[model samples]
Target: MTTISDGVTVVDHPLVRHKLTLMREKDRSTKSFRQLLNEIGMLLCYEVTRDLPMEMTEIETPLTKSMQPIIAGKKMVFAPILRAGVGFLDGMLELVPAARVAHIGLYRDPNTLQAVEYYFKAPSDIAERMVVVMDPMLATANSAVAAIDRLKERGAKDLRFVCLLAAPEGIERFRGAHPDVRIWTAAIDEKLNEHGYIVPGLGDAGDRMFGTR
Candidate 1:
């Protein structure tokens, strides 16, 4: 794994690499496309949570010996940055079933061409626990940055941004805005196109997943 910044981790797991190859294919159908993204997200979640606090717990076993281990915490929050981010939720929760979730709805202002937050919600323990923000595409970094800004305003401090893919431009912008926030992704593309999409990206993640276009 490569560190984009202090906390941002670029996961290079074999599963992520292999699934990403299929995701990049033009022939991959929407059903397969969505499945691959979730599977990849599940794999990526493993690394992002490596530092999570785990406490030893004791439990009775069916055999003569008695021992068991369970996680300890109020619960981590997975806050998806609307639309596409919601796709990674099930995959992430499959690993951390007890975790809470919050949704932040944002859309670009057509006239100003900037991100605007329309809705947001999080657990009361946000500041005390880790927060993982999800968005499959980090193209220009505008929306990702805006999403974090809103999360912070809502009392989230220990924050991490997780995405299926990112472009260099978006990575730079995200880091510049929130140096303390780490990023996790399956792959980081080279550049953004004139229209703000990552060149050679898996097209629009939301469109591909939902077959909207």
Candidate 2:
């Protein structure tokens, strides 16, 4: 892992980079792209949860009794921002099946490039749990910032943001809006394009994942 700043980490694992490169190929099929994303999601999940608190638990073995470390405290919530973010859920769930899910639906306006929320659902006790927000690309950060704003209004305190790729502009915007929340990403690209997409990023993650235009 590489620390870009006090709260930003880049997961530079070889497998993650390899899979991400495959997903970036122009001719990659929908099925292959989705599969690679899921795999990378699992890998990223491992990196992001590395510092979770642990407690010793007593267990009986055939030969003797022993204590083992297990995750402690209330289960975390995985908050995915709409269509593209959902692509990261299944792989993360494979590693953290007990985690609760929160869905935040927001779409970017073509003209203004602002986030508009359409749906929000989360646990009533969200205030008591850690929340990890997932989005594949942090291009303009409009959607990410809006999603976190809603979650904070709902009483979420401890929160983190994860993405497959990030643009420098998006990072700056997101940090400026929500500096308290840490970020984990596989790679931080150069910058955002004229249309607010990350340059060198796999285009339109939602459309690519869902096979939509």
Best by lDDT: 2
What tens digits encode model 1's per-residue C-alpha lDDT throughout 81-149?
Answer: 877888898999999998899898877564655778888888887888789999998887788898888
| Candidate 2 off by > 4 Å | none
Off by over 4 Å in 1: 64-69, 109-113
**Superposed Cα deviation of residue 124, candidate 1 (Å):** 2.8
- 90-145 per-residue lDDT for model 2 (tens digits): 99999999999999999999999999999999999999999999999999999999
Worst 10 residues of 2 by lDDT: 204-213
TM-score of each: 0.92, 0.98
lDDT at residue 105 of model 1 (Cα atoms): 89
Model 2: number of backbone collisions: 0
lDDT of 2: 0.94
Best by TM-score: 2
> Each model's C-alpha lDDT?
0.85, 0.94
